[model samples]
Target: MSADILTFRPAPLSQADAARRRAMLLHPSNFVPASAPDRDATEKAEEQAGRFDALYKEFLDRGLSANGARTEVARAAAREIWDGFAVQLRQHRAAGQQMDANVLAVALASIQCLNSVLPRRPEDPHHAVRAVSTARRRLQYNGGLLHRLHPHRNPAFQDAVATLQSLEVFLTRPQQHAA
Candidate 1:
Protein backbone atom coordinates (compact mmCIF):
# COMPACT_ATOMS: atom_id res chain seq x y z
CA MET A 1 0.00 0.00 0.00
CA SER A 2 1.28 3.47 -0.82
CA ALA A 3 0.97 6.37 1.71
CA ASP A 4 -0.60 9.66 0.63
CA ILE A 5 1.42 12.92 1.12
CA LEU A 6 0.36 16.58 0.98
CA THR A 7 2.43 19.82 0.65
CA PHE A 8 1.19 23.33 1.52
CA ARG A 9 2.14 26.56 -0.21
CA PRO A 10 1.08 30.11 0.45
CA ALA A 11 -0.58 32.23 -2.23
CA PRO A 12 1.25 35.27 -3.61
CA LEU A 13 0.12 38.70 -2.37
CA SER A 14 -1.79 41.00 -4.72
CA GLN A 15 -0.26 44.33 -5.81
CA ALA A 16 -2.29 46.32 -3.30
CA ASP A 17 -1.41 43.99 -0.41
CA ALA A 18 2.26 44.08 -1.39
CA ALA A 19 2.25 47.86 -1.45
CA ARG A 20 0.61 47.98 1.98
CA ARG A 21 3.22 45.58 3.36
CA ARG A 22 6.00 47.75 2.02
CA ALA A 23 4.48 50.81 3.65
CA MET A 24 4.17 49.02 6.97
CA LEU A 25 7.80 47.94 6.80
CA LEU A 26 8.92 51.49 6.03
CA HIS A 27 6.81 53.07 8.75
CA PRO A 28 8.85 54.42 11.66
CA SER A 29 6.53 52.96 14.31
CA ASN A 30 6.88 49.44 12.94
CA PHE A 31 8.36 46.99 15.42
CA VAL A 32 10.09 44.94 12.74
CA PRO A 33 12.90 47.44 12.09
CA ALA A 34 13.79 51.11 12.33
CA SER A 35 14.45 53.04 9.12
CA ALA A 36 17.56 55.21 8.65
CA PRO A 37 15.65 58.50 8.60
CA ASP A 38 13.77 57.54 11.73
CA ARG A 39 17.00 56.68 13.51
CA ASP A 40 18.55 59.99 12.51
CA ALA A 41 15.51 61.98 13.69
CA THR A 42 15.42 60.13 16.99
CA GLU A 43 19.11 60.73 17.55
CA LYS A 44 18.73 64.44 16.85
CA ALA A 45 15.82 64.71 19.25
CA GLU A 46 17.76 62.87 21.96
CA GLU A 47 20.76 65.17 21.49
CA GLN A 48 18.59 68.25 21.84
CA ALA A 49 17.03 66.86 24.99
CA GLY A 50 20.46 66.20 26.42
CA ARG A 51 21.58 69.74 25.72
CA PHE A 52 18.50 71.16 27.39
CA ASP A 53 19.03 68.94 30.40
CA ALA A 54 22.60 70.15 30.74
CA LEU A 55 21.49 73.74 30.59
CA TYR A 56 18.88 73.10 33.26
CA LYS A 57 21.51 71.47 35.48
CA GLU A 58 23.82 74.43 35.02
CA PHE A 59 21.08 76.78 36.11
CA LEU A 60 20.41 74.64 39.16
CA ASP A 61 24.11 74.68 40.04
CA ARG A 62 23.98 78.45 39.89
CA GLY A 63 21.55 78.32 42.86
CA LEU A 64 18.38 79.08 40.94
CA SER A 65 15.20 77.60 42.35
CA ALA A 66 13.64 74.70 40.48
CA ASN A 67 10.96 76.85 38.88
CA GLY A 68 13.44 79.59 38.08
CA ALA A 69 15.85 77.12 36.48
CA ARG A 70 13.06 75.71 34.37
CA THR A 71 12.06 79.18 33.23
CA GLU A 72 15.64 80.05 32.31
CA VAL A 73 16.01 76.82 30.32
CA ALA A 74 12.78 77.54 28.50
CA ARG A 75 13.99 81.04 27.66
CA ALA A 76 17.25 79.62 26.30
CA ALA A 77 15.41 77.12 24.14
CA ALA A 78 13.00 79.80 22.88
CA ARG A 79 15.92 82.03 21.90
CA GLU A 80 17.48 79.20 19.91
CA ILE A 81 14.18 78.43 18.18
CA TRP A 82 13.66 82.12 17.38
CA ASP A 83 17.15 82.45 15.94
CA GLY A 84 16.63 79.42 13.72
CA PHE A 85 13.30 80.86 12.56
CA ALA A 86 15.00 84.13 11.68
CA VAL A 87 17.60 82.31 9.58
CA GLN A 88 14.88 80.40 7.75
CA LEU A 89 12.96 83.64 7.15
CA ARG A 90 16.06 85.18 5.58
CA GLN A 91 16.57 82.17 3.33
CA HIS A 92 12.93 82.23 2.18
CA ARG A 93 13.16 85.96 1.45
CA ALA A 94 16.35 85.46 -0.54
CA ALA A 95 14.64 82.76 -2.59
CA GLY A 96 11.66 85.08 -3.14
CA GLN A 97 9.25 82.44 -1.92
CA GLN A 98 6.45 83.30 0.42
CA MET A 99 6.95 81.93 3.93
CA ASP A 100 5.14 78.63 4.15
CA ALA A 101 3.03 77.23 6.99
CA ASN A 102 6.05 75.61 8.60
CA VAL A 103 7.88 78.95 8.90
CA LEU A 104 4.77 80.66 10.24
CA ALA A 105 4.30 77.83 12.73
CA VAL A 106 7.82 78.46 14.02
CA ALA A 107 7.10 82.17 14.35
CA LEU A 108 4.01 81.40 16.39
CA ALA A 109 5.95 79.08 18.65
CA SER A 110 8.65 81.70 19.12
CA ILE A 111 6.08 84.31 19.99
CA GLN A 112 4.40 82.02 22.50
CA CYS A 113 7.71 81.08 24.03
CA LEU A 114 8.76 84.70 24.41
CA ASN A 115 5.41 85.59 25.85
CA SER A 116 5.53 82.77 28.39
CA VAL A 117 8.89 83.87 29.74
CA LEU A 118 8.29 87.59 29.76
CA PRO A 119 7.24 89.06 33.11
CA ARG A 120 3.81 90.69 33.11
CA ARG A 121 5.43 93.99 34.01
CA PRO A 122 9.06 94.10 32.99
CA GLU A 123 11.50 96.40 34.80
CA ASP A 124 12.44 97.97 31.48
CA PRO A 125 9.11 98.43 29.78
CA HIS A 126 10.44 100.33 26.74
CA HIS A 127 12.72 97.50 25.60
CA ALA A 128 9.93 94.96 26.00
CA VAL A 129 7.49 97.20 24.12
CA ARG A 130 9.92 97.68 21.27
CA ALA A 131 10.56 93.96 20.99
CA VAL A 132 6.86 93.14 21.05
CA SER A 133 6.08 95.83 18.46
CA THR A 134 8.79 94.54 16.13
CA ALA A 135 7.53 90.98 16.37
CA ARG A 136 3.95 92.14 15.78
CA ARG A 137 4.92 94.06 12.64
CA ARG A 138 6.86 91.14 11.19
CA LEU A 139 4.11 88.65 11.92
CA GLN A 140 1.42 90.94 10.52
CA TYR A 141 3.35 91.53 7.29
CA ASN A 142 4.15 87.87 6.76
CA GLY A 143 0.68 86.88 7.88
CA GLY A 144 -0.83 89.00 5.14
CA LEU A 145 1.29 87.18 2.58
CA LEU A 146 0.48 83.85 4.17
CA HIS A 147 -3.23 84.70 4.06
CA ARG A 148 -3.03 85.45 0.33
CA LEU A 149 -1.17 82.22 -0.33
CA HIS A 150 -2.92 80.05 2.27
CA PRO A 151 -6.27 81.44 3.25
CA HIS A 152 -7.18 78.54 5.53
CA ARG A 153 -4.62 79.64 8.13
CA ASN A 154 -6.21 83.06 8.58
CA PRO A 155 -7.57 82.25 12.04
CA ALA A 156 -4.18 81.29 13.43
CA PHE A 157 -2.59 84.48 12.15
CA GLN A 158 -5.48 86.49 13.47
CA ASP A 159 -5.10 84.92 16.91
CA ALA A 160 -1.39 85.69 16.88
CA VAL A 161 -2.12 89.31 15.95
CA ALA A 162 -4.60 89.61 18.78
CA THR A 163 -2.13 88.11 21.27
CA LEU A 164 0.54 90.58 20.22
CA GLN A 165 -1.85 93.49 20.60
CA SER A 166 -2.77 92.43 24.11
CA LEU A 167 0.86 91.85 25.01
CA GLU A 168 1.73 95.31 23.70
CA VAL A 169 -0.97 96.84 25.84
CA PHE A 170 0.12 94.81 28.85
CA LEU A 171 3.74 95.90 28.45
CA THR A 172 2.88 99.57 27.99
CA ARG A 173 0.61 99.80 31.02
CA PRO A 174 3.56 100.19 33.44
CA GLN A 175 4.91 103.10 31.44
CA GLN A 176 1.55 104.85 31.55
CA HIS A 177 1.49 104.45 35.32
CA ALA A 178 5.00 105.92 35.59
CA ALA A 179 4.01 109.00 33.58
Candidate 2:
Protein backbone atom coordinates (compact mmCIF):
# COMPACT_ATOMS: atom_id res chain seq x y z
CA MET A 1 0.00 0.00 0.00
CA SER A 2 1.40 3.44 -0.91
CA ALA A 3 0.95 6.25 1.57
CA ASP A 4 -0.52 9.43 0.15
CA ILE A 5 1.25 12.69 1.00
CA LEU A 6 -0.21 16.15 0.76
CA THR A 7 1.88 19.34 0.76
CA PHE A 8 0.64 22.82 1.50
CA ARG A 9 1.27 24.93 -1.55
CA PRO A 10 0.58 28.60 -1.17
CA ALA A 11 -2.40 29.70 -3.21
CA PRO A 12 -1.85 32.23 -5.97
CA LEU A 13 -1.77 35.68 -4.43
CA SER A 14 -4.81 37.91 -5.08
CA GLN A 15 -4.44 40.98 -7.34
CA ALA A 16 -4.47 43.28 -4.32
CA ASP A 17 -1.80 41.19 -2.59
CA ALA A 18 0.34 41.15 -5.72
CA ALA A 19 0.07 44.90 -6.11
CA ARG A 20 0.96 45.42 -2.44
CA ARG A 21 3.98 43.15 -2.83
CA ARG A 22 5.14 45.06 -5.87
CA ALA A 23 4.73 48.36 -4.04
CA MET A 24 6.63 47.05 -1.02
CA LEU A 25 9.50 45.89 -3.19
CA LEU A 26 9.54 49.10 -5.22
CA HIS A 27 9.28 51.57 -2.32
CA PRO A 28 11.04 50.37 0.83
CA SER A 29 11.27 53.89 2.26
CA ASN A 30 7.50 54.19 2.33
CA PHE A 31 7.30 51.45 4.95
CA VAL A 32 10.19 52.33 7.21
CA PRO A 33 12.79 55.08 7.69
CA ALA A 34 16.41 54.11 7.96
CA SER A 35 17.55 54.17 11.57
CA ALA A 36 20.39 56.52 12.57
CA PRO A 37 22.69 53.79 13.87
CA ASP A 38 22.13 51.71 10.75
CA ARG A 39 22.77 54.71 8.56
CA ASP A 40 25.94 55.61 10.49
CA ALA A 41 27.33 52.08 10.26
CA THR A 42 26.64 51.95 6.55
CA GLU A 43 28.46 55.24 6.09
CA LYS A 44 31.46 54.02 8.02
CA ALA A 45 31.66 50.85 5.98
CA GLU A 46 31.54 52.81 2.73
CA GLU A 47 34.18 55.19 3.97
CA GLN A 48 36.68 52.41 4.62
CA ALA A 49 36.29 50.87 1.17
CA GLY A 50 37.91 52.31 -1.96
CA ARG A 51 39.38 55.37 -0.31
CA PHE A 52 42.13 55.49 -2.96
CA ASP A 53 40.12 54.49 -6.04
CA ALA A 54 40.50 57.99 -7.40
CA LEU A 55 44.27 57.57 -7.23
CA TYR A 56 44.52 54.04 -8.70
CA LYS A 57 45.84 55.36 -11.97
CA GLU A 58 48.17 57.72 -10.14
CA PHE A 59 49.68 54.87 -8.17
CA LEU A 60 49.74 52.11 -10.79
CA ASP A 61 50.09 54.26 -13.92
CA ARG A 62 46.93 52.69 -15.41
CA GLY A 63 43.24 53.31 -15.31
CA LEU A 64 40.91 51.21 -13.12
CA SER A 65 38.92 49.89 -16.03
CA ALA A 66 40.20 47.06 -18.18
CA ASN A 67 42.49 48.13 -20.97
CA GLY A 68 45.38 46.51 -22.76
CA ALA A 69 47.69 49.10 -21.26
CA ARG A 70 46.46 48.51 -17.75
CA THR A 71 46.89 44.74 -18.04
CA GLU A 72 50.40 45.27 -19.34
CA VAL A 73 51.28 47.58 -16.48
CA ALA A 74 50.08 45.04 -13.92
CA ARG A 75 52.00 42.26 -15.62
CA ALA A 76 55.10 44.43 -15.71
CA ALA A 77 54.87 45.10 -11.97
CA ALA A 78 54.67 41.36 -11.27
CA ARG A 79 57.60 40.74 -13.59
CA GLU A 80 59.73 43.31 -11.77
CA ILE A 81 58.94 41.73 -8.41
CA TRP A 82 59.77 38.31 -9.82
CA ASP A 83 63.01 39.62 -11.32
CA GLY A 84 64.11 40.93 -7.94
CA PHE A 85 63.40 37.58 -6.34
CA ALA A 86 65.14 35.77 -9.19
CA VAL A 87 68.34 37.76 -8.78
CA GLN A 88 68.35 36.92 -5.11
CA LEU A 89 67.69 33.26 -5.89
CA ARG A 90 70.64 33.12 -8.27
CA GLN A 91 72.96 34.88 -5.86
CA HIS A 92 72.24 32.38 -3.11
CA ARG A 93 72.93 29.47 -5.46
CA ALA A 94 76.17 30.93 -6.83
CA ALA A 95 77.55 32.05 -3.45
CA GLY A 96 76.85 28.67 -1.81
CA GLN A 97 74.81 30.24 0.99
CA GLN A 98 71.49 29.10 2.40
CA MET A 99 68.36 30.18 0.50
CA ASP A 100 67.65 32.78 3.17
CA ALA A 101 67.62 35.98 1.13
CA ASN A 102 65.50 34.57 -1.67
CA VAL A 103 62.94 33.19 0.73
CA LEU A 104 62.78 36.54 2.50
CA ALA A 105 62.09 38.25 -0.79
CA VAL A 106 59.15 35.93 -1.44
CA ALA A 107 57.53 36.88 1.85
CA LEU A 108 58.26 40.57 1.40
CA ALA A 109 56.78 40.50 -2.10
CA SER A 110 53.55 39.00 -0.79
CA ILE A 111 53.18 41.67 1.87
CA GLN A 112 54.20 44.49 -0.44
CA CYS A 113 51.81 43.35 -3.14
CA LEU A 114 48.93 43.20 -0.68
CA ASN A 115 49.67 46.55 0.91
CA SER A 116 51.03 48.66 -1.93
CA VAL A 117 50.82 47.14 -5.38
CA LEU A 118 47.22 45.93 -5.35
CA PRO A 119 45.68 48.99 -3.71
CA ARG A 120 46.11 50.97 -6.92
CA ARG A 121 42.69 50.24 -8.40
CA PRO A 122 41.52 52.27 -11.39
CA GLU A 123 37.87 51.69 -10.51
CA ASP A 124 35.98 51.21 -7.26
CA PRO A 125 34.15 47.95 -7.91
CA HIS A 126 35.99 44.70 -8.64
CA HIS A 127 39.15 46.47 -9.77
CA ALA A 128 41.01 46.19 -6.50
CA VAL A 129 40.04 42.55 -6.09
CA ARG A 130 41.27 41.71 -9.57
CA ALA A 131 44.57 43.52 -9.10
CA VAL A 132 45.13 41.80 -5.78
CA SER A 133 44.28 38.43 -7.27
CA THR A 134 47.00 38.89 -9.85
CA ALA A 135 49.56 39.63 -7.18
CA ARG A 136 48.29 36.86 -4.93
CA ARG A 137 48.57 34.28 -7.70
CA ARG A 138 52.18 35.16 -8.47
CA LEU A 139 53.21 35.27 -4.84
CA GLN A 140 51.54 31.98 -3.93
CA TYR A 141 52.99 30.14 -6.92
CA ASN A 142 56.55 31.04 -5.94
CA GLY A 143 55.92 30.78 -2.24
CA GLY A 144 54.60 27.26 -2.67
CA LEU A 145 57.91 26.23 -4.19
CA LEU A 146 59.80 27.91 -1.40
CA HIS A 147 57.71 26.09 1.19
CA ARG A 148 58.77 22.74 -0.21
CA LEU A 149 62.51 23.46 0.17
CA HIS A 150 62.46 22.76 3.92
CA PRO A 151 64.59 25.67 5.13
CA HIS A 152 65.63 23.85 8.36
CA ARG A 153 63.61 26.13 10.64
CA ASN A 154 65.39 29.38 9.93
CA PRO A 155 63.42 32.05 11.83
CA ALA A 156 63.45 34.54 8.96
CA PHE A 157 62.31 31.89 6.53
CA GLN A 158 59.55 30.87 8.89
CA ASP A 159 58.55 34.48 9.35
CA ALA A 160 58.33 35.04 5.65
CA VAL A 161 56.17 31.98 5.24
CA ALA A 162 53.92 33.18 8.02
CA THR A 163 53.52 36.59 6.37
CA LEU A 164 52.71 35.08 3.00
CA GLN A 165 50.12 32.82 4.59
CA SER A 166 48.52 35.83 6.26
CA LEU A 167 48.35 37.69 2.97
CA GLU A 168 46.75 34.70 1.32
CA VAL A 169 44.14 34.70 4.03
CA PHE A 170 43.39 38.35 3.43
CA LEU A 171 42.98 37.89 -0.28
CA THR A 172 40.71 34.90 0.12
CA ARG A 173 38.45 36.65 2.59
CA PRO A 174 34.91 37.60 1.51
CA GLN A 175 34.60 41.33 1.12
CA GLN A 176 31.53 43.53 1.44
CA HIS A 177 30.32 44.55 -1.99
CA ALA A 178 28.29 47.60 -2.85
CA ALA A 179 24.50 47.46 -3.06
Candidate No. with top TM-score: 1
What would the per-residue lDDT of candidate 1 be over residues 1-179, giving only the tens digit for each residue?
22322334445689999989876754435432122335554444434344445675787799876545545554554465456556666666677756443655646653753655345423344555566666666676555544444564534454554545544544344322311
C-alpha lDDT (0 to 100) for residue 52 of candidate 2 = 27
Which candidate wins on lDDT? 1
TM-score: model 1 vs. ground truth: 0.37
- C-alpha RMSD by candidate, in order: 16.7, 19.0
Question: Which regions of candidate 2 are displaced past 4 Å?
Answer: 1-66, 98-179
Could you give me the TM-score of model 2 versus the true structure? 0.31
TM-score of each candidate?
0.37, 0.31
The local distance difference test score of each candidate is 0.53, 0.45
Candidate 1's displacement at residue 102, Å, is 9.1
| Per-candidate clash tally | 0, 2
